[model samples]
Target: MAKQVAENIQTVLRRLQEGDLLPVYLLTGEENYYIDVLSDFFENKVVDEVSRSFDQTVLYGRDVNMDSVVGMAKRYPVLGPRQLVLVKEAQDIRDWEPLMSYLDKPAPTTVLVFCYRHKKMDKRTRLFQQLKKTGEVFDYQRIYESQLPQWITDYVESSGYTILPGCALLLAESLGNNLSLIANELSKIFAVLGEKGAVTASVVERVTGISKEYNVFELQTAIGRRDVVKCNRIVNYFAANPKSNPIQMVLPTLYSYLVRLMIYIQLPDKSDAATALGVNPFFIKEYANAAGNFTLGKLASCIGYLNEADLRSKGIRNAGTVTDGEILKELVFKIIH
Candidate 1:
């Protein structure tokens, strides 16, 4: 009954596959990969398509209060030996005291799964405490940019596909936080490659339509080196392939990098500061060298440029139609100049 934190999505699935059918399950996170996987797992294990009737129910926590959830959970299973109850988007619920009370003595024949999306329950909440003590809890935090390669490799391997390390990072950057979309993309790529095939950087490039030669990372590198020609070329490349190399994609990563640099600037120019920022030590070494090239004022200006670019990308600013190349060129000029 000790609190178990499922740091990895696969770890939670392994537990479920091992038949760790707890009476109550509380899954909450921004990552939908874990939520969707668990929901599907419960749907298959708890209710068969032919047998699903009164005993199986899927409810949204937003529309239904704790009383409604408790009421359904308390109900006896019909002709079926067990009841399957799933509460999706549980973050929408206002109050959960009633639900917590019911967890004290959950119905023996009921499997209640509460899938909280985009947020987590307050640890101080009684039900959360109870879940930590008795129920299964899975927390799927987003994988960091650096760790994404290994994560993708493992994910693809688990799904009966082999991906080269270089292609893994390429996929991670291309797909970003959209795991479902990434999976779908990979599925398509795999189908095109056929069985017993390995995914190389070039093969991934050919199938996914994201070139390894010119990507956001390279663009950032170009900007960092103040190579105007390379920067303009990358921007043009993105403009030519806006679907795969969207403008919105670069802002988040650029903003994140600048924010980290600002944070690093405050700390002593030492390796520990980079380590504390959770960046790669090599990047830290780079930053240690690069930090001197720009002032706090310049970094702040870069952030402003990213912010303006982000707004323009979202169509919030720069109302007139403008090419992605122009926007990116302006952005690069703002930071570099």
Candidate 2:
């Protein structure tokens, strides 16, 4: 069942190239990046270039109704054995019943693809159930923060490059979980570094224009060690570059770090600490150090400080003239002290 859903674009394209085409595909998800990739592949790859001129049809949900889609799907190919009917923005289609009925007896020679972006189809619905029975349904879920480091490593390796230890985590911290943005940044880095070199932390910082010395990851480490001077320097850098290091983003990450530290302290089995905290084993030492530095009571108070700092960053209950830099300085001071 996992293999059937086609998690990666390469799998779907490989199947298509092998002539293992399905009659219908319902590609729906919050992640539009994968949906766009698969939908574009079907548009351009499913048929030969010459045959596509006559056999391919692209329809949008806003511009056409379900009847038009069914009508398109039932048409015979002009120059080949197969035809491609692709519907983009499928979530906008209000009437799915006609499409569901069409899926029940879809044309044998036509390949129907639906690109539903920004949301998923309800699994309990009859339409989704019918799709499962008759065609392919790929659900593209957003990558979680904990999964980003490994994902980055895999993506870099797949692109024929290797990333040094901590490079992936640095990129994940700086870029967050936006896959498309990260991919684009990686493309630039690869283009500059060429194919053979290892992507070190320095390489990532240089190529992506994110700071290696003053990033949130380093700041988190500094706070864990109770190094007030290091924290002050990093926060000062952040204060100088407010656009690069917004208080809103920093506060949440810091808050999350403290919360995870609190959890690490409470767990009975130290062996399972990394798994429970959803962090890599390599970084377990940092959490261990943080747990030692902060008692459970102090950890709770730090979390409260972060909560209040978060509110102030958003201009909620914030007094006049407190800049983001000042708030960050104060927050770091409180945490370090």
> After superposition on all CA atoms, how large is the RMSD of candidate 1?
5.1
lDDT at 99, model 1: 78
Question: Model 2: per-residue lDDT, tens digit, 27-104?
Answer: 887777678778878888899999988999988889988888999999999999999999988889998888878877
Best by TM-score: 2
Clash list (residue pairs), candidate 2 = none
Model 1 local distance difference test score? 0.76
Model 1 per-residue lDDT tens digits across residues 56-106: 989997789989998998888886778888998888889888876788898
Q: Which stretches of candidate 2 lie over 4 Å from their true place?
A: 1-9
